[model samples]
Target: MKQPLLTTDFLDRAVDLFADDVGIVAEDGTEYTYGEVGDRVNRLSNALRERGVEKGDRVALLSKNSHYFIETLYATTQLGALFVPLNFRLQPEEYDYLVGDSDPDVFITDAEHAGTVTHLQDEGGVDEWICYDADDAEAGQWDDYEAVLEAASPDQPERPDISEDDDATILYTSGTTGDPKGVVHTHRTQHYHAMVHAHHVEFEDDDVLLWTSPMFHINGWGHIYGLTGIGGKHVIVRDFDPQTVFERIVEHDVSFLGGAPTVLNFLLEHNEEHDVETTGANPVRVETAASPPPKRTIRRTEDELGWRIIHAYGATETGPLITTSNSPRRIQDGDKYDIVNKPGFATINTEVRVVDEDGNDVPCDDETKGEVIARGNQILDRYWNKPEATEEAFTDRVEGWFHTGDIATMDANKMLTIVDRKKDVIISGGENISSIEVQDVLYDHPDVRLAAVIGVPHEKWGETPKALVVPHDGADLTEEEIIEFTRDRLAHYKCPTSVEFREDLPQTSTGKIQKFELREDYWNDDEDRRVN
Candidate 1:
């Protein structure tokens, strides 16, 4: 006999199993127990029903990582409604486009962001706004979430019987060309992904999982459901700061945390100059994705901070945890230089390949690079309302595999390494410059906190690499210095001809630099703008 598959239904079951146990520690020090969490989710679901949110209705949320954010998601799931989470970092104009595209039945937002929601509402056609705190709010004409829940029912209906192939989420992903497309996933895909994470990263029932990453990001790598299914603790944080993260890890004795290279770099850089230590007997584990980690920082994280960092690679369409580097030998014996830069192996049940433009599988001889494609139980079902886009993503024509458009290579041992995003390569003076390579060199500079590289227009070279940098706090910087820093490390053509300083760089909710946004300013004037 086989065991039953875990599903979203198991999320509420965890509340019952862990009832009275602490569920979340808010940024402001507020604690919500499992019982309270269950109650809130129940009330939110009831309130959503009161607004006539039927099964399959799109209910969107735009907010920071908070207890309420988690509640809204589970609440939406309980009713079989699609949970469409907007990136809180998106500007109002971008939000307008997403709102229009998703066409959500109800838009929930925190009071601080009420103004933007209202502005969006005024532009016409949204059904309603549910504000987190509307008691003394300035954004008029919106339902106060707390007020509505006070009178709302807390008796949750039986969990809907959603099919394994039924749509569960629709994540919008940015493209190199045109507007972002919504990548849709199903309950079966997500549940399978959760199991893969458990196998790859060893998520035990006793683990206390931290939400340093956004809940909107592949549902926190399915840990929201995966951890709950195993009766693990959930720790919530609204934002990431080195001191805040360190304190929480110690305070809650957190066993696991996940983020992108940006967050890991911040923690490592901050810890190097400050004294930080874990109070727990075991060192905590940090999971990184989005971009591969830099070799130097990976070493610093392990040697100086005494924390272990592992890499997992996937896109929003695939539920974000398909492949992970988690074997004990990989952790113990693998070179930091190699492991940090590689995308690792496919998780159990995930099949990955490096294929040429013709869709033929490239030889795994370490030297041959090709487009990285994957097919697995975790792959998304479709793109919501966009059949053409869905068809293109699922079938790359060559091998019937879902093409990721990312260039990569694999060793004989099957440790996968990323070459570059097929679309982000900088072709200048007939030479291909990997933007990641240039950016990695820039990050090696002691004064650079964050860096992104994109192609800018150039008459002589056709296109030249441009660098956008955020210097370490209180560090003085100049364009000449940035160019000089990369000059010795990278080829002359790959070195940035121009540099721009920002107090902070723009990032997606997943902590990926919004290179598309950075590329926009450079191409605004040209009608036929092509970065390469």
Candidate 2:
């Protein structure tokens, strides 16, 4: 009596029940009914089929936020082909490795980013090139996206027999070294992950989501399935702007949106200066992840913006949703920010543990820190064509669990607070310091707009903590003043030994700060230099 759990079920259900509803609001403000969207998907799938895309073939897409991105996702997966969406922010030179690895049968590009990968098409091993807005793309034999759909039959494309366990999509994550690792997810993994995500996030047909985050990121944090399946509307935002975010949320009656902590920080800074409207006809709740946000940031979001925070944690390899802090019961008993600020508990159908090097669980005392490992259905099936890397990932400390590489502490309530990344931890004279803890203290300073704490070389303490602060517009900050600010709140050892003021910090396309790039500047090829 059990039906197969497939990602296709999401769009199929939307087309069946909410076919006439405005399902997608495009980047250019065009709206498409679910029926129209499904027709477009069918047509695209038919076109791809004619182009020799079969089951097991890979169809890679390089685009920013757009409605066609969703269409391309469902269309490729509908035919049981693996859909590989490249990070649109990547440089043209970076695609050489990604394209060669995935070896997609067809490569699709948005006109805006088509040129980024156009130079790789011939020698890149991709058989076909399909460009959206072909008129604007670089001149080539690229088939126009709309024309391909227009010429193809609007009838539903013939779907190959697909199993829940079949490989669905390959998401590439920047590896610590070497080439970016392709994390593989199956139909069952994404399908089950979406259902659990929808239940926890409380999505509904009436809910409207603003695409402040890119769809390329773990399939918009897996919302493309959960929200679409629930028949909610998606309003696209290709380029993130605080003013535009406010405009679209109120314009679209957006009830839900997700972004990294850095994104929220930008919005907070923008709202403080411009005092932009925060909400619309519906209440808004933001799902923040990518990196652990400062405690003050969460409190400001709730207090200043009057929006609820749903803090969750995970990575590209672990379904990106194995933990969350949106528990209503815990919220009623606990301090509001205390619960949401930390990655509270393992999500439904997921298991999380903080263990030491010997695989022993750490005490739930909130003071002890250990590496966080997760076991979940949403955990990736494998690393695409990288079996050795996959094996090394799973067997690190625990035998079978997926090692998250995040250092954390589980409270008596079993709510885990991530202290720092395993590598980001600063050890000074044998005492461990959590960089996140120090950063959180800096955020409490009203003049501090943004902050990143990293360990730097020290003559005495082996390696000591340093702070990079981006101050408020006109507020003047001094190193000694910033030093005393942290000393008042945190342990002397954890406080920054030095403070450097900057106008801004480097961030990923999704708004997460690139801490590795910051670290690389301080420590280069000095194995003896790390605070490790």
Evaluated with TM-score, which candidate comes out highest? Answer: 2
lDDT of 1 by residue, 53-72 (tens): 87888898888887788788
Worst 10 residues of 2 by lDDT: 523-532
Clashes of 2: 0
Each candidate's root-mean-square deviation in Å? Answer: 2.7, 1.5
In model 1, the runs with Cα more than 4 Å from the true position are: 1-6, 120-126, 278-281, 331-333, 397-399, 473-503, 524-532
Q: Which residues of candidate 2, in runs, are more than 4 Å off?
A: 527-532
Tens digit per residue, CA lDDT, model 2, 1-532: 9888898999999999999999999988999999999999999999999999999999999988999899999999999999999998888999988988999999999788888887876684788899988999865668999999999998998799999999999999865456799999999999989999898899989999999988998888999999999999999998999999999998988999998888898899889889999999999989998888888889889999988999988999988888889899989998888889887798898999999989999999998889999888999999999999899889999999999889999999989899998888898999999998888889889999889998888889888999999998889899999999999998798999899998899877777666777777788866544323
lDDT of 2 at 263: 89
Per-model TM-score on C-alpha atoms:
0.91, 0.97
Cα deviation of 345, candidate 2, in Å: 0.5
